[model samples]
Target chain A: MTSSTTESEFGESRESDSDNPSVTKVARSKLSIALAAVFCLSVIMGTGPGVLLVNRPESISGIPLVYAWGILWYFVQVAVVIVASLTVWRSTGVAESCRTHNAPSRPERNSAERGEGELPR
Target chain B: MTIPILVVLIYLGVLLLFGWLGYRRGERSEEDYYLAGRGQGWFISAMTIMATFFSSFALLGAPGMVYREGLVFALVSLNVPIAGVAIYLLGNPIRRAGKRGGYITQADMLCDHYGDGVGLRLLVALVGFLFAIPYVMMQLKAGGELAAVLFSGYDHAFEAGAIVLSVITALYIMIGGMRSVAWTDALQCALLVMGMALGGISLVVSMGGPSAFLHEVNQLPTSSLTVPGNTGFWQLPMLFTVCLLMPIGGIIQPAQWMRFYSARDADTLRRSALIFSVLLTGCFIFAIMPIGLGGQVMYPLELSADGVAPNERVGSFDQILVVMLDDLMPRLLGEVAGATLSSLVIVAIMAAAMSTADSNLHALSALFTRDIYSRFLRRGCSEREKLWSGQLLIFVATAFSLVLVLIGSRPESSLSGLMQMIVTLALFAVAFSIQLLPMTLDVLFIGRGTRNAAIISLSCGLLVAFCFTPLFPLLFAKESSPLILWINAAKELIPMHASAWGLVVNGLVFVAVSVIESRVLKARSV
Candidate 1:
């Protein structure tokens, strides 16, 4: 396998993305950090010790409190994922990267160019 | 009986058709066969990932757990979303690495990142082998259990059911590889979701709808409504740790890891994550959770000196769902209509089993062919030869797991203790798989871990986890041994899942080894 080119190229691309601090790059980083914060907080509240607050026989709108707590966290997690996908993931310039890295070597360049094969690396 | 059998036969035929289609569309390259050319769309990716993530664990095992433990499993259900978050967080990076490095299995990326070494590659493959076998065994066991419940009085029904499931799953994966597995998973995922929703609804309706159902649930014993449950097993610490770790372990397992590599793009995985989190979690909370709770209200456990056991009418806790469907459906919806829906749900349960079985079998084949056979046994094997070897491995692995499941199915067999609950097998598998977490994180993000650190930490973790498994004592010591007694005592005191224990030791060792290795390298440089 062409192991060296693959690892070095990927490593270099990742490093360069961090080194060149353009406005979009900085914003993307901030969004990613913020998104991570929300995700972590949600996990803590959703499944962690936060569950103790609702681990009871009491009902909310006729649903059991613990079950309701879980459902609430599920929605929070979904929102964080949706926000990350739309903002951070969408703006990662994955399409451009795919075109630069995969298009030249792959037989399916047309599809890559159309953003159908635009993966992270 | 005839209608349900007809439904199952039809379902099996559709699966074979999908397998043939995958073969016709596939290229002969190993990449195409193993990773589906790394070009799956969001829909197939989402469904396949969810289907493979779930398994008999979702349909039979989870409900069985809820029936056995109560509302504690409800909270454990939250682990689904954490797994969803992992798909994008861990998956995108892994996909990027796989695409860039032309990697196929978990061993590929890990070996490349840690500076490829034979020891590291073999250990990584060992993790995959250890994790996949028990998981595959559970799915096959689920098939036999389903048959035993459905076929009731038939001779050798359990054996026939398990063999059919193993043969069908192995044949498709052999014929079409990853493409067939993913395509069949898509169909199976759909069936599984429908089955969960319909099963929940049927149970609710049988108890006279939502308000009546909730009222009946509220009237049950307090043990059934709270944590530590009826059996007093899922205490707070155990629930929290298992909920936190198991999903991460599940996502990083061999099958799901390859699914990330198989995705068309980051966007496909992102969307897949969203769908998996929202849709599947919804199914769990609304659809699957009820089956177990409803089973309690419908069948009600018999509290004995041996602790809480399933009602006399219920064959076993895992059989609760099928038994409830058999008893309740015909009474509520009349014979023909009820039987049809029941058959569909039963096939859905089989789909859940097959979807997971095919993915794990397909992944195990890749691990063997790419990491072991081609790399060591045949240094310069042809692509055709590699593919053929992988197919052969799938058949052999399936048969091996089938034999284990058959043996364990016998009540007199010693292995029956390990096969008690589908959830127990799932946890046992994850204990090994979660051992991959620390090394995977270091390789993907931290980048400070040495090759030696990875190997040492992984070996330590696997050993620790193995010592905790039910099989460990069975193989090595009598239950009365001092070592076995101490281990059980520690487990009781800690109350965390076996995987959590493995991961704890794995993380600590990894950090210690990586720190010392780094310092030594720094001193050498100075």
Candidate 2:
């Protein structure tokens, strides 16, 4: 059962890679890693908008300069969406799917004996 | 009774219908009772994840925080991507471990490694329930207040709210169980997002457009948006801490872990985490910041006979959003919108609270039945009896929280203050189990440490967190000055902004004890 699954998975990967050119389902670069790092840093280095407020301390009439804090903040938000979309989009089955290929003999047999196993769901 | 009553009843009745449908599958086996028979798919997992993630804390607390703090409060949410990554990193392995062991709680993963029997699992689950009750009460508090506020000038509004919310939630939870919670969450989440957007728009429009509101608010001293005192005194360290650690605290949450257990595979968990990350990001960034900013712009002052600014309530920041609703929305539409928003906020909060609560309650019950009860009370009891014990525990836990709610009500304290105090109990409780952080890292990568060592480290970590709570106060009093205390106290007292130095202490002890255990094991082996 496990061997047959691997053969099919290999078959699927070959068929898909030939058909689709835009799918690279893994984070495999200094650039990608750097971008991921930068994204994470902005979140962790949550220095208040004070520094930004200092640079643009003057709000005209009633508008707080921080109102457009979105310009900075949303960029970070979109950056995350970009990275996430990239990661999931690329790795449809590339890095290695979770292991479900073993001949379920050991677990099924063991549980049958214990009366506690229900096929590991 | 009224159209509003009909809407609420239909809403709740539909929920019961869903729950009944789910219960139709049967719950005779442990598979059905605990993990939804482990048949949950990507969509259910995602919906459950979103619902639980976007709960009352986001709905009410986000806006309330904005009311108290400024637009800056929403900044804490920026951590989601990172938190998503952290959870993706942590939750995946934990999910894998759970799939391997049929372990349902966060402590299940921990206990399996630590060999501390159920002691560690019991500790984590018990803490989860303790922290959960108050957070649940906060939702109940919001739902009840919103009901009373909407039904203003009506008799028995408060009593009506309590009855309506509790009965509705209880019926759905009891009937539908976990599946009901997840499905209702999906429908409710969609409504919640739309309602928040509409309300935000209405507030902006009613405040005389962004132009006018901004113009008026710009006239106030800059200190208005900044904290009460100047010198960036209270907030500098606060933003960094709350924004950082709370997301980290989220990683250890057993309720959140339960969502992982329900997922079909690693791929589904990954996708769900990714989707929810976006949802959570949008939620935090939009939900409260706009409300906080709106409060500043819209509700300038109450009029006096002489037309001077009357003495405004100093700390009632949460009421700003409500006031804005009254000002921006017309009498009736405002009421409907408010009611809808209230429903979303209440369910979201309750969902978050309940998802976390039920998972924790189960974990606690497991400790009694699987760990403590079976160990002592009735050895080798039938699996069916053990399952019932878990259900009984859930009822007891719900009752305990109801008691906590009654107790929480009579106390003369600020809402934000109470939220901080209660959440602190949760953070402090779980902070100890963080020994698992390093342990988790090792297991996923290095494969180090014995079960005994893990337990000792976790216990010591718990101790240090408790010690710091009292120690910090004594330390503050002896400093012969109140500046640091005042600054720290500001965060500690407010629910969203509490000082997290205890978390730091907790982390350090957990690490130290784990290291101690690791080295001791190495030496003995040599």
DockQ of the two-chain complex in candidate 1: 0.19
Q: For model 1, how does the per-residue alpha-carbon lDDT over B156-179 read when each residue is reduced to its tens digit? A: 988989999999999999999899
Which 10-residue span in candidate 1 chain B carries the lowest summed lDDT? Answer: B108-117
Every model's TM-score: 0.92, 0.79
DockQ in order = 0.19, 0.22
Q: Which one wins on DockQ?
A: 2
List CA RMSD, all candidates.
6.4, 6.3
lDDT of 2 by residue, B290-312 (tens): 66566655444433345323126
